[model samples]
Target chain A: MQLEVKPKGHTVFVYIKGEIDLQETERLRQEVDRYIDHHGMDHLVFDLTQVNFIDSSGVGGIIGRYRKMKDIGGKMSIVGAKPTVEKVLIFSGIQKIIPLYQTEKDRIKAEK
Target chain B: MNVNEKDFRVKNQIRLTIQSRAENVAFVRACTAAFASQMDYTLEEIDEIRLAVSEAVSNSIIHGYKNDPYSQVELYITLWENGGIEIVVEDHGCGIADLKQAMEPTFSTEPGRMGLGFAFMQSFMDQVEVKSRVGQGTTVILKRKVRQPVESKN
Candidate 1:
């Protein structure tokens, strides 16, 4: 998996490409957390458009990041989840805690 | 227990044994998804199968083997003639003492781990049965029926 971060004002958009599974979740978690901490971003937008598959481990990793961000009074949202990836998120009930948007522009607009 | 028993008739069966390493989890998922593809399952169904298989194999590696790379986790896939697929992931590592508590959602024994493995398996497959003994091992069996695409009614 590849993680790229784009800073737009106080919100940072993280573009994750490839499958998020047990093999790659830890690296993803570390990279996202490190980027967020270094940039001192107050909000996060996880772009999952290119992610084709996600398992429970991926869900756990996302939730972990959510908690980390929440503890610091920050916000996080997920955008561009494919149907298959969306099913996993919805099934795991992560969508209830974190808002899911169809596109990054929608998520950014909603946050505004 | 006769060799000619009807229950022994499996149209196609494949068994794979791999080390309990994190890298092997993806291999297991890919192999199971490929096997399920033989039934001509839709992409959505195949993704679900892959997710379920990854969860089970991850549990075997993380919880069962405790990240012990030398341990082995076995995966078995069977395709029945009746358009049904069965997958079994087994490990001879540490077994769960309380099966009920283990199956509960969000019940992870370790930090940074979500206890939704069994939940995903149960949600994705038509049937999920887990059998484990404290000292023996754990075996998770998942079954799903594939529907063949119908011809257009032109």
Candidate 2:
């Protein structure tokens, strides 16, 4: 997985691409947490348009990150998950708590 | 031998082994998705395959091995002629003490588990047969027919 950070005003957008499985869970968790701590960004957006697969472990990692961000008064939003990935997220009840946007533009708008 | 019936055909097979971790779920999903795509299965059929495979692998990991990497899960897949496919999932770990309870839809050894894995496989596939014994491990056999749908009467 690749993490690209784009700072647009006060919000920080994190773009994640590739399969987020158990193998990549630790790196992802650590990277996001480090970024949150380092930058002190209030708004976080995730781009999952290129992510093809995610399992329960991956979901757990994301949920963990969301919780950390939430605890620090930061907001996180996800954009562009394919149907398969979306199903797992929805089944795991992650979507109910996190707002999912259909496109990057919409996610940016929500961050505002 | 029937000379006309001797027309040649070829078969394909796929196999995978994964550790008993929640992480393996992605492998299962990717593999099942690839299989479905190769056979041009419909979206509904693809979802069914994903769910069934998930249950099969999850059962092997959770019940058979109990998250012990020392225990290994083996998966064998065969694509046969006449649009038939067979999947054999085996685990060498702690075996189920009661086959009946294990197959029950609501019976689960793991807390928060729905125990719908076997039931889901039965509902989605053409055939599902499980053979298991205490101290002998478990094997789940699943078969599905592609390119054809079971007809239902109105």
Go through the candidates in order and give each one's C-alpha lDDT: 0.87, 0.73
> What would the TM-scores of all predictions be?
0.92, 0.65
Which residues of candidate 1, in runs, are more than 4 Å off? B1-8, B148-154
Q: What is the C-alpha lDDT profile of model 1 across B6-56, one tens digit per residue?
A: 434576899999999988888888888877877767888888889888999
Clashing pairs in 2: none
Stretches of candidate 2 above 4 Å error?
B1-38, B42-71, B80-84, B94-154
Model 2 error, position A28 (Å): 1.6
| Candidate 1 clashes between residue pairs 3 or more apart in a chain or in different chains | none
Per-residue lDDT value at A100 in model 2: 89
CA RMSD of each candidate after superposition: 4.0, 6.7
Candidate 2 per-residue lDDT over residues A1-112, each given as its tens digit: 7767787877777788877754576688888889888888777878889886665456667877788889999878889988877876676667777898889888768756
Query: Candidate 2: which docking quality band?
Result: incorrect
Tens digit of per-residue lDDT, candidate 2, span B48-70 = 67666767877877688886765
